[model samples]
Target: MTAISVQNMNVWFGTGALRADAVLDVSFDVNEGEIFGLVGESGSGKSTILRAMVGLVPTWSGTMQIAGETLGKKRSQAFFGNVQMVFQDPYASLHPRHTVDRVLSEVMRLHGIADVDERIVQLLDDVGLGAGFRFRYPHQLSGGQRQRVAIARALAPKPTILLLDEPTSALDVSVQAEILNLLADLQQSQGLTYIMVSHDLGVVGHLCKRIAVMKDGEFVEVLSVEAMRRLEASHAYTKHLLASSIQSVS
Candidate 1:
């Protein structure tokens, strides 16, 4: 099953003289139960593509399909239910005033899902968060803990496709490893289709089966993990990015 198909996708912000293109003719496919990695440097339009997929950037012109339903045209509740996103900043994603329970329960209520206490608890557990922390506020949790809450919130909706925007970029190296492991475990158990955007090639290599490298709002290279490990010749931009990312990781 194909989870997402983006064709001739073009994104530009503003209008007339103020217009600036964020993504230009970008295209990709994410298969069901597979992790498709999107990698690029800063200002590479990675997040812009995600924003377009979720209908946040509706001004863009392209063809995007999520689970056989065309985006932008389909406003069905089922469409929203099948897709969910975990943003880059856990601190910003969650409301400081809302408890973990409230955050998860609100989504449940919106989806007309009743008796979510048990389900929420299970989701929290699945994300490695204990029941004792269920009622705690965001400020009470550590960076990793808060990210876990964000992941739990995303999973609480029971989405088939998860769009992750550098999910572990803010954490320490050790914490990043833990979160990466947790994400891998969750993907395996749930059979999820993941579209992860990150600048970290190591993270992409570890978690994703295939990776698409973006440059100037377009994908310049798509390579398998093995091909990347071999360090074969690719586009100049991809080569530069790989070298820089490797240096950063070292």
Candidate 2:
């Protein structure tokens, strides 16, 4: 079954002569429990698609079906409960004044979930947090720990689909693998589907079987992780990106 379906989606800003297109005529489908990757540099319209899907960008045009519902200008309450997003910067995503417990509790409250206390404990554990960190502020935790809390908060609503926008990009290289491992484990355990946008093919390949290469607000190509590893690309831009990724590490 398909978890997400997008057809000829276009997102733009401004109007008339001043208009700028962020994403143009993009379409893709993600199967249940699959991790789909979108890779490109800044202003490549990679993140615009995710924002459109979650209804963050109101000036979008096209069909978006997620979690079995056709999207409209506004997202329903059930849609939010079924899908959640984890942003790139953990510290910026979370409130400094809110404790871990308070943050998780508030989400659960808004979702009308029962047994908030027990669920909070379980979510913390699921994100690899200890009981001692429950009442701590975002400033009190390390980068990785703060990201774990962000993951925990996204999971607080018990979503089946996750929108990850460069989830580990802000973290140290040491903890990136740890967070990636945690995400992979969580997906397998919870049977969750993910749409991940990242510039790092290595990170994307770790969690995604297939990826779409976006450039100038359009998809240049979609390729498998195996082909990417073999450095086989159909487009010149993709070849350049693959080469860039390789040279950065070597």
lDDT of each: 0.89, 0.94
Stretches > 4 Å off in candidate 2: none
Candidate 1 lDDT at 67 equals 81
Per-residue lDDT of 144-189 in model 2, one digit per residue for the tens?
A: 9999999999999999999999999999889999999999999999
Model 1 worst lDDT window (10 residues): 71-80
- For all candidates, what are the clash counts? 0, 0
Clash pairs (backbone) in predicted model 2: none
Top candidate (TM-score): 2
Q: What value of lDDT does candidate 2 attain over all alpha carbons?
A: 0.94
Q: Which candidate is the best by lDDT?
A: 2
**How big is the positional error of residue 172 in model 1, measured in Å on the Cα after superposition?**
0.7
